[model samples]
Target: MTSLPESPRPAPTRAAGAFEVRLSDSPLPEPDRRALIASPRFGTVFTDHMARCTWTAGGGWSDRRIEKYGPLNLNPAAAVLHYGQEIFEGLKAYRHADGSVWTFRPEANAARFARSAHRLALPQLSAEDFLGSIEALVRVDAAWVPSGEETSLYLRPFMYASEDFLGVRATQQAEYLVIASPVGPYFAGGVKPVSIWVAQDYHRSGAGGTGAAKCGGNYAASLLPQQEAQSKGCDQVCFLDASTNSLLEELGGMNVFIVGADGSVATPELSGTILEGVTRSSILRLLADSGHDVQERPIALAELRAGLADGSVTEVFACGTAAVITPIGRLAGADFDLAVADGAAGRVTTGLREALTDIQYGRAADPHGWMHRLL
Candidate 1:
């Protein structure tokens, strides 16, 4: 019953059901959506419509629709709340300079979402259907996309087990939904340097854990360390590899990068433990395109501190969908601390940030064809 045409690729032998778009008659008025867009805050407000698809073992996927946004009447024994079989993704829709709305590298997110679904034992949605769902939502809520500096509409697509029975395993029924929210500037005034606390006591995930997947439980595991960082007046938390306890891994929500004094940039390699962030991958491409030597390898904590102390490391930044790029000014640990480039944002950091945003907003030429126009 899906109105969106299917791709010519062969369907999976055990594919989930496709969804249908049910246009909302009571959609938000233009004036109201515009008013909300004028000063839209991040993740505070939602659009008028949301895309949903349900899955079951016997019937496969069915009852797909873009229904009105509201609370769901869930049973007390829903599997998601009890068993935590859920996964989600975060991406943005940028309103281009010419008033066109587009998303950056959504195919990456779709593929990651499918991987997360498989890891969680949930039904996997096809890449075509995933892209179509995002397109449908963005098209319906195009009015909610703001056109201010550093402003965008953040899209969150999530899937949760919805079976009423809870047996501590993967449920047969699952629900997938996509929601949009117009967001303001991530930084209030300007992009300032952030301090990161080393999470020495707690490890976010192990080697074989679901660390690479963008699942809810991984984030839930970091809340305590995040709070600890907040209490120490730091902005974010950085974790080391659980086994070695020395090599760099990633931050709570973003991937970390360091610029060496040798005019080279280095990021932690995606070793099945770090989240493969879209922004991180984009930065790698942008930096390489700009003729900067980029390396994805294992960097040790001692090396980072030594580089910072000797002025060999020029800049350090974190990248993700939400924060985009945040320069890490200082690294704090139990016994020592080091500041990169006098705790100031470096030239390379700002340049890469601008380049990525340029391609995102369509102000510069997208040589890589990373943007997909939705409206």
Candidate 2:
């Protein structure tokens, strides 16, 4: 018997130009805003406005607008308050040397946001709306986009269950918002290698869980282990698979990669427990384009240990939205400690970081068309 053909994907809904603009009346003065942008913390300083929209089971998405940035009012019994039904996406808007603003692969972030909403029982927002919201906020607060070296406006788009019921069922109402913050380098010391603590006691995700989704609960669960890593004098924490605890999973907030001396690069495969990061995929593409043997497969902890001991694993690094790429300097556990090749940033790691950042800040050509112009 012949099998039926797969269904065609639905066309993305277009909601651009739907957000109504309501500029803030008491915006910060130019000098103050400039001072804040000069040396801004990662997520602390915010722009003057934010974009918002509401979703309902009956009415669907409505009331899209750009409003003043401030605290949100939620019911005490909101589903997200107790059930943790929420999702978020992070990306950046860069100011090119020619004074144009752009973002890197926002469509990828929008697709992932939809997948996360499906996983968390929240409403799936359209790609047009997602991009529209970001553009709306950035257009009103264009000055917030920093022009310094390695500085950009960090955009955070998030959705949450706004329904007041607490019956543990899917939310009937939801709210989506986009906020912007000017940020400098993710790491304060500027691209230095970092130490990691291998988490022997805690696991990030299991066989069937929300590990693949970008939600608040997953991050909430990692706080204790991260604190433990800090106590051990490490900058980050590495988690192993939950089933056997022998395979490498990921770091606390980023994906990990191992580079071999033989010009092979490998990272943990997407096993339904690892968050598919946009930066991670970009680096993988860069690696493949440069003719490196890129492998996405199960990386056994024992194998990594053996490779490091024998000098087969020449470099290690982590990638995420916040920290674009960070070299793994040392790996420490309860029983063992291993430094990655004299504890300095490796050649491959630095090269990939600069290559990717070049494409981001428009220093080099974007051959893959990953950069999206926002303004």
Candidate 1 residue pairs that clash: 17-61, 19-64, 20-64
For 133-224, candidate 2 gives per-residue lDDT tens digits of: 98777878888999888899999999999999979799999999999999998988978899999998999888899999999988887889
Q: What's the TM for model 1?
A: 0.92
Candidate 2 positional error at 190, Å: 1.7
Q: Count the backbone clashes (under 3 Å) in each candidate.
A: 3, 0
Instruction: Tell me the deviation in Å of residue 220 in model 1.
Output: 0.7
Distance from true location, Cα of 214 in model 2, Å: 0.3
What TM-score fits each model?
A: 0.92, 0.95
Q: What lDDT does each candidate get?
A: 0.85, 0.90
Could you give me the TM-score of model 2 versus the true structure?
0.95
Best model number under lDDT:
2
Error of 2 at 33 (Å): 0.3
